[model samples]
Target: MDKVKFGVLGCARVFERRMAPALKSAGNAVLHAVASRSLEKAQATAGKHGAAKAYGSYDALLADTDIEAVYIPLPNDQHAEWTVKALAAGKHVLCDKPLALSVSEAEWMAGAAAASGLRLMEGFMYRHHPQHKKVFEVLRSGAIGEPVHFRGIFTYPATADHAGIRWNPAQGGGAFLDVGVYPLNAARWLLESEPTEAKAIAITDPTSGVDSHTAALLAFPNNRTASLIGGFDQAFTSRYELVGREGSITVERAFQVGESGVRVLVRANNSDTEEAFFFEHTDQFQLEVEHFAACIRNSELSLEPGEDGVAQARAQALVLSSL
Candidate 1:
């Protein structure tokens, strides 16, 4: 396929503001269709995104033979069900983060994808950003010399609307499932190991019955450890610091690297000097879309494959259980 045709499974705000533009920017992909429960909304979104078709239901979009892949930005609880359905319909899937609410569901989705011989990937746009690659390169260069600890914070004030999906517990609303996964995934990626133990403390909202704030601790092998804070009712902050034997590295605005330049700060052991590494901004979502399209064209798995989603969900389940 010269260009992989994509069908968006929802007209969610994230799709309108981010993924739609990303699809337009991706070199090897096209925004071919969109679907929503409401036909008018679907048509409006399709018009805005330049999709050729719009459907009143997700099933209709899945049935469209022209759509070779589906980008699912549905609620966290809906990811596995729709991903399995899309795979059954012969469409590769790029599901938004928290690929499933549970490890079992993630494993089931992965199994379905494998059975259908289709590619399935979780949408972690930050991993595709050039800044993260730079960080990895710096780490590999021994600039941070054997990282021993990671501290990450991702938090933002929640809207007053208690009816919002993000604040609705029945719909899989919570801080941990939303933004907490980023820091946890970062810790695992940077350490190149899964956490051996995990624990978390959460503050549940009185009215919403969902966790409004959470702090988690993960212990990896080699005596390495990580502390992560995520909250839905807090001042806006997103950053991380990796401490090593020789030095430390800090990333500001870590999760949402937007289109502006970002900086990484490095400090050597016993040195007051802090060096800054700047990275020109790029569209990470576009890169993510292009990479998925490439994997589909080449008949290979994505860099963040379905199994990775399962691993993430497993760790998440462990933490949630502990909480």
Candidate 2:
């Protein structure tokens, strides 16, 4: 039972709170090292996470031969640049979501990974949850008849940190990149097809030049449709519902489940029957890391590789352009 040694490229908040523990706990992965531009921060995170080493710079961490994999939680704008660098350095990469700001950057990163013969994945941890698998299973069983429409919403109250990256346009801060990617990807996954057209409208925060709220209608192949909403200025809500010909399925915690059990509610028999399915607390982040690490060790384990991220980027770009 060998474990992949992981070097994390950033000490971002998500890394500190969730991914650090996940990388440490994953059965097939080890948090070997962490890096940040600030030596002090890197050292503190390493010590806290029980990582073996810390580096003052990303290059230093990438140069470490012992590190077999890299988890990148860098800013949205840096995902491509650092992922390419990590891949070029002969390391498998697990990058944060909205893999890149544009399709070009995502494609470039995918190309680098392909050329390097290294594994590359985007970190959409929610998709790794068994709850989603159950939903798919239910769909397959025809419990929902045929999924035709999806409505997703992910929002959190506006941030108070005006100077933070969430409001910083240069860092690729926007509702779509920050949270909308979930529903966009989910629509494709549940609908089982790429969207053919997108119509979107956004409420931009004039002060910050970042979209505070974005809503879109996606037209999928065969007349399947989806409505997605993402926002940084709204009541906290994270959920999605799929409406089918005969029934509907709703996931209460569609994303960002942090050690909490989630519920999947369903209505069937033409809305005359109702049932609920429960998935006990399972750390999706740990599952995500372990899956990727296992794929790195054994070629048999399938993965949502970098190409999927590129497709996601294409949809994202399309949504923005439509807006």
Candidate 3:
């Protein structure tokens, strides 16, 4: 099968720093084109990444018949609009996480993909990392008994000025929308269930009106629970724990494990020493792109898909409502 020809929809920092390089390395995909609001920037990005085509605007890239799939790393607010446009142009889509600011927008994006019979996946790159698979394997082996509780943390001290697009609510920037969704998705993934109830609290910055920190508790079925915290008001950490009846498991450097070794720790109830699982660094973004390409090329290949994105937005909406 031919590699999926991917057209990048924006010059987002994530693209330049991560996804562009990942797409270039993916065995099942090619970085065919790149577009930006500025043609000069687009040209520079294409030259830097060795993309074959560059367009002044996203619409131009979508209009290009050669691009078989599109990767959108746009601002949160722009995801739905560009996604629908790309699908309408008969291309599969892989949009960045927190798929949209609201569930309605996510549904619309999903609906467009269904109407066109195109593959649509949310770009939760970390899920493709091998460390997470190890976590699940440990759980299945009963190292962690019947899963009962989850604690997820993803936070960092903002090194940049506090006045960027992240501080703007209209741009769909906030602690929960940005990094908090990772824990939310992780809980749903590991628990294999959805929440029945939710509660949350957030500390909003006065000048920005965006929550600098958000903490939430979600109650899942069968007495399972997850407590999550995400923000720029704390030291850098990306980790999560799953506590079962007999023991607990912890994943270190969980979400941001780019090109670095990762660890998972397991502690039994009466253990003097804890067991450990280690994984060597791997490019999760390349794995994610390859998976998306496989999904595009065959109906049998599973995808994270649009409905998952919609559910993620729905859960985020619940947390926002509680705040």
Candidate 4:
């Protein structure tokens, strides 16, 4: 099997903790380079991640002939710009979630990818995790019997770092763009449709000029509705529940890791019983990298395409706008 050589577009903290290791461990991918505005950071990331090259400029990474793919962990606002540039340069792109700051930007990205005939994917790694697949299978198997409603919550208290990107307005910092995206994405993926209508509320930080907390109600087809909550002013909590006519599917840790397994507790209406589905623990990041490599090797785009990212972004934007 030929390994897909990967060039990382930034030395973002997310890459150091998650994506870099995933690329290193994946059997079908190689971490070939990392680029950052700072040469020191780029060199450090390259050394730590076994990257063959380090470039001080993003453009330099794009120029590498050996790198067929680029993993973009840039800021939320920069996603579309870099992705369009990478696609135009004839390199496959795997951009971070909330693919762009706006629907129009995301549309432009999708267009660029189609025009270039290069693989373009938004990084919604959780959808590739086996546990999520199990959730889909159960839903498809009628275990839940017509999933009618979904409730998702993701929250983690933010540090008082005023300069952090999550608190910066120019870089697209807000709870809705950060943790909020997970619940929104989960709802969309499970329902497999775009949100038709939305209402939302937000608590804003006067100092930071960003929403510290946000809650939204999304109306989908089939008279279905989903409640999504994301915040930076709460204790760590991540969970989602899908309620149907027959039973309910509850995921304990909807978007994060745990020791044992994610519970898929199923309960029928009249029965005082529950069936638990146990899934083996695996690194979701590694699974994501493997899937990305598979898509590239097969000369295909990602399972979670740029459009999915765009849709999630649009939903998030609508929620924010409603707030």
In order, what lDDT does every prediction score? 0.88, 0.89, 0.88, 0.85
Question: Tens digit of lDDT per residue, candidate 1, span 71-132?
Answer: 99999889988999999999999999989898889999989988998888999888887777
TM-score of every model? 0.97, 0.97, 0.97, 0.96
Which residue runs does candidate 1 get wrong by more than 4 Å?
300-302
Cα error, residue 272 of model 4, in Å, equals 2.4
Instruction: Write down the TM-score for model 3.
Output: 0.97
What is the per-residue lDDT of model 2 for residues 56-144, given as tens digits with 9 covering 90 to 100?
99999999999999999998999999999999999999999878998899889989988998899999888889999889888988977
Kindly report which residue stretches of model 2 are placed more than 4 angstroms away from their true locations once superposed. Answer: none
Stretches > 4 Å off in candidate 4: 300-302
| Highest lDDT model number | 2
lDDT of 2: 0.89
lDDT by residue for model 4 (251-278), tens: 8788886556666677756356888877
Q: Output the worst ten-in-a-row residue range by lDDT, candidate 4.
A: 299-308
Per-residue lDDT of candidate 3, residues 155-255 (tens digit): 98875445666778888887888889899889988998888788999998777888889999999999999999999789988999999988888998888
TM-score of 1: 0.97
